[model samples]
Structures are given as structure tokens and as C-alpha cells.
Target: MKKLILVLVLVMGVFFSGNAQKVPTSEEIAKKNIEEMDKRLKLTPTQRSVIYNYAFDMAKEQLLLYKKQVAGTAKEEDETRIYRLQNEMNKNIKLVLKPDQIDEFNKLNEERLSGIDPGKKKKKKKKGEEEEKVVGIEGLKSTGNN
Candidate 1:
């Protein structure tokens, strides 16, 4: 009986631990974001450094907002701030890029915004259930009808 209980406890602990996701740190977020941009834009070392700073700042702000949302303390202003941060980051990134790079950056932004297909309806969740949260930069925008 004791061995059975020990085995059961170990199995339960492993199952719960496996289910828990570790949230990425702001630096991890920034590094991943910059890596994507580098692949698309072929950014120079200097440009990468500057853009990393912007992405890091944006990620930090987003993490704070996420915490508030999880705590059910998110305010309307948080959404507005997210949009503002995205715009600011885009503008700053553009400043660091060449004219050709700027065009590519703009194209990337357009793709990000338009990636969602409007024709498909979202699956309805049961009452009291929350909508699925989008992750990454795209998560800044609401997935519902605008």
C-alpha cells in the first residue's frame, strides 16, 4: 500500500509539473523577436542591437500587462498602451533600417496585422470561459471582430 501511494504521488507530481508552462523572460522574448526580424530583414549588428533594445522594452511592458490580466486587474488603458508601444517600436525600428529595409519592415507589419482570416468565425466558448489569448506581437491585437 505504501509503495502504491508513493508511486501515485510521483506520477501526479510529474503530470502537474509537465502541464505547467514556464513563461519566457523579457530577454528571451526580445532575443526571439530580434532573431525573426534578423532573418527577414538581414539586419546589421548595430541595427540588431538597437532593435533588440526596443523589443526588450516592449516585452517587459507586455509581461507586466499580462500579469495584471491574470490577476483580473487589467484596465482599458492597458490595451491602448499596448497599441502605443507597438507603434513606437515600429517607428524606432524604421529609424534604424535603410530605405529598402524600411519597406520590408512595413511589409512585415502589414502581414502581422492581416494574418488573421476574417471569413472564418471563431469557435464559441461556454459561458464564463475566456477567449484564447494570442501570444507574440500579434497578441497585442484582439482576435475578435474589430
Candidate 2:
């Protein structure tokens, strides 16, 4: 009957939509970002390898803390874990980089955080359309002109 066909279609749509929304793991995100940085910075092979390992470890620790927080762990416990991981990551980074390379690495990370990229062109908004901006606690606002 048509009812059965309609039900099957609806079920299939729901299943596919859910599959499409799968989020990447933190490790996957870190690896992707590290690869992007390597391409942008033109890092040497040795530096790339070292940076990849560093990013992986840092991301893994962060992901663990995030999982705990999401699982309703106490805020204090999450903060403590994050603080300890940050200290360890900082110490490891210092050990991995040479004096000169450390400066370059820091600069690269800063640029990445700032979203500065020569290869990416900023899109211009149409008249009467403004860039969407996020306000602290207030959520997102649509500007009339961007």
C-alpha cells in the first residue's frame, strides 16, 4: 500500500540524516589541523613529524577531559585535568623545538588562531547583509550590512 511505501521512505530519510551528522573525533580534528598547518608553514619533514605527534597527544588529552565534562563530571575535576594537561603539553613543546624554531612555531600557531591565511579570500557580503557576529552570552546577531 502507499502507506507502507511512505513509511519506508520516512524511515530511510531519518537514518540517512542521522548518519550525515556524525561528528569527527578530537584526534581526527587535531590531525587535520596539523596537516593544514604543515602545508601553510612549509614545515620541514622532521618538524612536521614532531608537530604531528605533539598535536595528537595534546588533542587526545583534551578529548578525554571533554568526554568527562560531557558525561556530567564536576567542573572542578574537568578544570584540574585541563590544567595538568596544558602544563605537560607546554613542557613537551619546549623540548621538541629549537630556540629559533620555537619562535616560528609560536607565530604560526598565533596566525592559525587568528585565521590569517594568504590562500583564503574573504567573501564580500551583499548590500544590506552583514556578517554574522557572536556576542558573549547574547548569542549571534545579524548585521544589516556586512
Q: Mind giving the per-residue lDDT tens digits that candidate 1 earns over 52-129?
A: 999899878877766776689988788577767777788788989999999988776654455432335778899999
Q: What is the C-alpha lDDT of each candidate?
A: 0.70, 0.57
Worst 10 residues of 1 by lDDT: 1-10
Task: Give the count of colliding residue pairs in each prediction.
Answer: 0, 2
lDDT of 2 by residue, 14-61 (tens): 434565566446577567757776665566788778877776776666
Native-to-model Cα distance after best TM-score fit, residue 121 in candidate 1, in Å:
24
Worst 10 residues of 2 by lDDT: 1-10
Q: What's model 2's lDDT at 127?
A: 97
- Pairs in steric clash, model 2: 130-145, 130-146
Global CA lDDT computed for model 1: 0.70
